[model samples]
Target: MLKPLPDTVKGPAMRLQHMVMTFRSALVDRLVAHDPALSRVRMGARVTLSILISIAALIAFHFLVTPLPSISYALAIVLSIEGGVAVRDRTPGEQLKTRLIGCAASLFCISLAALLEGYRLVADLAFLGVILAASLARVYGQRGFAVGMFAFISYFMGAYLKPTFAELPLAALGPLFAVTIGHLVRTFLFPEDWRRDLRAALKAMQGRVMDILVRLSVLSKEGRVTENDRTELRHMEEQLKDVVLMAEGLLPRQVDGTAHSDDDPVTALSMAIFDLHLSAESAIVQSLETPPPFVLVHAVISGDRDLAEKVAASTAVEKGGETARASAQALLWLQRSLQALGRAAGKEAGGLASIDDRVVDEPPTKPDFSWKNPLVRAAAQITIAAGIAMIFGLFLSRERWFWAVLTAFLTFNNTKSRGDAAIRAMQRSVGTALGIIIGLAAATLLAGHTVSTVILASACVFLAFYFLQVSYALLSFFVTIVLCLVYGLIGQLTLDVLLLRVEETMIGAVAGTFVAFVVFPASTRSNVDLALARWYDALGQLLDAARDGESRYRVIELSSRLDAAYRELTVAARPLGSAWSLVTRPGPIRQTLAMFLATSYWARIFAHDFAEAKKPLDPDVLTAIEEARAALSKAAARGSDCFATRKPRPVMAGNAAPAFRQGAAMGADRVANLLNRLYPA
Candidate 1:
């Protein structure tokens, strides 16, 4: 061997490797926490790659054939990005059809806008009509939504670029090229495979379960579970719940040549995972004096069945106090679940006999045009906001007025309430502000280097799309940088131009926020109440099914609905954590959030116990459930208090198993106490 490396070099190399590993671990944790399946990450990459390839193709075409307008290139990039996003969860044929429609709509809008360029007053009036029509088109479902977006963007591009009649034909090529490139990339490079995705999700869930088990094992061995450990365990439990829900959502409703039963292997795997999680939580909270079966933990992690059985069988002996006994019981259940999980995983690996693979078209339904319709309300809100933004933006800078309108329209894209709109607007402004500082420095440093500028812009596009789901602020920041690079390339880069962008962004945000609060405002409280009503309804059905000993399929279906409803309620109640909501209605908002959380937690535990127990409810427990259901129905109907006048007494039955009794009693007691706290006499 050659001479050994010096300590100086080796030390730094080791440190660098350690740093890299730490960073990678942190990034993985964050992504898994936010999106366990990594679906968003994949979509972002697909869109970014499509845009980059489209840009490269345009550059090559420009040199090889007749020169193309800069606006044409910009339009092509935008269409490509939108097409990538629109094709998700669709069949190849549907993707192609959507792309074709988007292209046609874009071409028509571009030509119309170009033809109307000289007529300022009529053009402005037509713009408002376009906004109204685009919003209304959402009644047609996803296709209509895509068409509306393409039409609006194409028209905005036409007005902003002000293409002449002679350039219209060449400009029309943008959407065509974009459609072709986007379809090719989506079909060939990133085709959707439901089977592969489901399997990967299952694997990810298993890995996360193992990680939690490892942590719990270490804590058990130490004989001291700290508060921090419990909190961390709770967080892990929530993340695992998200992953399980996602996996279940991906399960095929009907497999070919096989009865679509709820007793599928994947369903079994999910229940096993949930059971293990429940056991882990119990052990952690009780602080097990006896360490977990080390050999069994190793066996599960290593997939060694023989050792697992030996350890699991040896741990059947009861030991220590009540807490220790509880912990031992949890460990015994965990072992059985792990064995069941292994069997399910093995069966799933063999794959379904015949997947249906058929894409059923949803029948067309009548469009709801009433004022109460969400689509109608959204369109009206965005149209009003855009109108206000356009007026103010014209005063600020007539040529760049579309920027403000774009911001205002996008602020309400997915937002439902005034609080959401305000938060989105605030994020956009803050993102733009930070972007300006970074953009200035970047622009100055990369000046006089066209190649470097192009590369930097492409990088920014990738980063912007990657963070689209993770953080709106990050997306906005990268998008602003991309705009800065574009301006630089067009010989229009200046401090004044960047500053004007900031001013326009703020104006647009304020306009959107104002419209959200003033015109047909959707309050956060109302949204939360609606979500709560839905969740309560689902929960009531699930309780009835479990108590009445309905079919397993019915219980599973109702449980899935309950999970979905809880997710919606979570989203709706998010605004309660905002400083504005807390400051405005501190007591009620805080109490409502606490009650929602407490109810969800206990309800989940109760559902899990009943699902596993598979026994008819005791009479006392049935009566308690019926009382709880009636109380919940009244609370949902009233949209507020149900226990203001009198509270129901807690019920505990001795006939049920200890676990079932505990779950039922605790769930009822927690709900009653939290509701009283929320709506005290």
Candidate 2:
């Protein structure tokens, strides 16, 4: 390096390097966000564990069954490991519940599928029924998800494993055995604490938020903001939003007989977790354009307890610019909230902040099974798709029609939109093809050895779970390899089988994708708009709660919900944010989004101030808020129509006044502007 560049060039280079680092951070977070040790667990360690388990399982069970069931149990072990490993594993009870239900449902489906194998018409109809039933499983929430997943797997195995009628019904027990072993390994062998897991998740999220604040402080020191800085800021906003949701999800569930008294510290902390996230989100938004002094912000982010309290004491009444005040407030609230969380978690204030106990518990309610439910619609549509795929599969190869049927059953299983289905279809095809190629090479390279097969299968299974949620493509690849290796374990891995698997999957996946497009197709754009519209509608409900003046907590709680929904809607419509950004300069759409954000900010301000008010708001003020809610609701409807229908709605003139309500009026104006821009008057 002969010479250094000017500040201009150096700045850009620095920004590029920072952006790359941020991207790397995002990737790393995606890979191991759910579990910390998972990312650190080396490939060698995984392989060692796999080989040892294979040796033990194979030696014991080799005489009873061939490599197939032994490998199946190993598969279960890997699944268990995916749930939890060592004592670092968290949520043993929840994992057990999920595994138990999934096992039962899977076993039943496998048995039923085997029974229906000989009856071609009846088999097709039965599969259709299973597909629909799996789709309808969403009504039960987490239980439903587990059941649906196991149901699909069971259906796939029963349909494809080709268990002969001569074989004992014991064949159906393979998955049951696999899942049971998986649960045992996860719960008894490598148990995880749900509260600890939740606590860890929360702490990690808090740390990330701190990192963001630190980064912001460093940037603020430079005193010059660039487009790259803005981009990075936006990325931080998004990441924070995601992490906030993740933290909320980790809140300890109410357990029966727990000391969840209203005044209990843990109970209050659990409830306040929602508030923390909302406040943190609001803080992130506030700090983007304006940051406080680096020292002040840094002390808070660093969890310097005494220093943070000093900063809060000094900054609370200090006369400063609005931006500086907002920044100070954001940092103070973030610190206080996280500190409270730390104390409630019964851990070091800055060390980990993981909860080891739960104090809140509520009785469970019966699940709704109404036909009008979205889950029912999902079931009906998915059944139709599966039926179509079955017919297509028979057309492709009656001998291997199960593959096609399996693909259809898998595609629409849990996807919320046509884009999701289409994406899965593409991912499955590409991943399967790549995985098959790798499996074929492995099958050819080392086909006869039991240890080799198990080892390879184990590695694939581990990686499959590793990338399970991180990337569909990678997950599909490893899953395909594991499936093929399973075939190899049975001494049936061949070119003909591999090619047929790929071909039939393509057929089935393609048919399911087609059905996804044709039958009740959910467009991503439309869904986003609808979600946003619903968010706005919820805002109205929030104000109504506030206006009812019955309880201040209701108002606070509703406002918190509004904040959370707004964040969700913002995340959901990010693609539109890209298009809305292309206008090159500040424009109506851009302004509108900003106005909506501003509306949220002002609304939060009102709620925050109202929280301390001893009496209800004036009637006139309540009337003003009601009027604002109605106007905002109408604007949302029109915006939805503009998106849902390819038609534009005429803007209606509406009266608006109160300063706090002006942002809502502006939000309406932006909606109108966006409608005109996208659909035209």
Best by lDDT: 1
505 Cα displacement, candidate 1 (Å): 0.6
Structure candidate 2, residue pairs in collision: 89-192, 254-360, 254-361, 255-361
The lowest-lDDT stretch of 10 consecutive residues in candidate 1 is 648-657
| Per-residue lDDT of candidate 2, residues 1-681 (tens digit) | 113333554577786776677677777675555454343234223433534454465456645764343324433443334323221223566666776776677667766877888886787688777777777776777667666766765666567655665442445345444555555554454444445555666666676667677777776687555668666766765565565556555555445643334454444554456546545655655566565666777787777868865765574426656655766777787787777766755633322244344434445777777765656666776777777777877876777787777677667654666656766777788999999999888877777887888778777766775565566688779878877877887887888888988888898788878877777766656656767776777677666766676455555555656667767655455434343222223233344444455555556545555554546576555656656665665566566443333322222111111133332233333333332333344
Model 1, 82-149: lDDT tens digits are: 88665453678988998898898898888888888999877877777788888888878888888888
Off by over 4 Å in 1: 1-36, 87-89, 255-259, 266-270, 273-319, 358-363, 582-591, 614-618, 640-681
* Cα-based lDDT for every prediction: 0.71, 0.60
